[model samples]
Target: MSLIQACVTAATTLLAVLIGGWLTVRTQDRLWRRDQERQWRDIRLNAYTDFIGAVREYVAFILNPAARITVVPRPRDPGDLMPFFDDVGSRYRERLESTKTALRLVAGRPEVVSVSAELVRQARLLAAARADSGVEALQADRFDALWEAERRFIETARADLGLPSAFVS
Candidate 1:
């Protein structure tokens, strides 16, 4: 072939290769994004379930701290706190799995890590609050601090996910 024709053929092949590469990348990228969104939703759901359940447990425990600690020393009884434990435990496990999946999908987004850490912190605080119950905890700052932390977490979650305050768990 002539020199000009050879150059034209080479350019065409190069263009075709580039276009094919771009198409493949686009398709993969789209699929990845879709999957990332799915994972985000799943993690959020799990986080909500466990986190909200924990919050409800705290509220109930607070309503009658005397009954929970004094009247019924076995606060973990099914009628009082056992069920909450089960719910929180199951939900937390689910949340953990979903979080790992999301991290894999998003490749370690810092916000997610921070949120997860806060979730742990909140759980620990609640557990601590439960430990100091009845009259001993009536004016304890631990419970208040825990409540404040939870409120902050809810607000942060809302701001990040654009969910309403009611969506907080």
Candidate 2:
């Protein structure tokens, strides 16, 4: 073949190879994105469940200071439950922080962020109820208010977490 004909053949081969490489890379990227989405769903499920556990613990803490709380090797009940109370409080705090980290890694969807924040608010309100101590009826009313807030905040969390309403009870 002539020199010009040889160069034209080589150019055609290069174009075909480039197109094939592009197609392979595109297919690989699509599969990888699907796998990452599945992993995200799993992380969300774990984080949501942890949030539920922490909220319920706080509600119990607020409803009755004298109620028993248990840990390995011992169970504790006291008017002040100070040491045990502090431990439980810390546990909830840590769970909340980890959930936040997971959300950030997932790009922090607004639904998840709002619901999680509401649950945290409920926990804090219940903690405040435990601190309310006085003979007055108005002081007693704080417990009632705290209980209402518990239901309100947790409902939002449940919906965002994709949990059924039946699970709320």
Relative to the unseen true structure, what is the C-alpha lDDT of residue 81 in candidate 2, on a scale of 0 to 100? 25
Q: How high is the lDDT of residue 48 in model 2?
A: 61
The model with the greatest lDDT is 2
TM-score of each: 0.46, 0.54
The predictions' CA RMSDs to the true structure, in order, are 8.4, 8.6
Q: Which lDDT tens digits does candidate 2 get at residues 16-65?
A: 99999999999999999988776866776666666566566655554554
Question: Per-residue CA lDDT of candidate 1, range 1-169, in tens?
Answer: 8999999999999999999999999999999999988787667656555555645554454444443321223344233222133443445435544554554343323564465455444544454445455435445575566566566656655555556775436
- List of clashing residue pairs for candidate 2: none
Range of the 10 consecutive residues with the lowest summed lDDT in candidate 1: 77-86
Q: Give candidate 2 regions above 4 Å deviation.
A: 1-13, 64-107, 133-169
- Model 1 off-target regions past 4 Å? 1-7, 62-147, 160-169
Q: Candidates' lDDT values, in order?
A: 0.55, 0.56
The best candidate by TM-score is: 2
TM-score, cand. 2 vs. native: 0.54
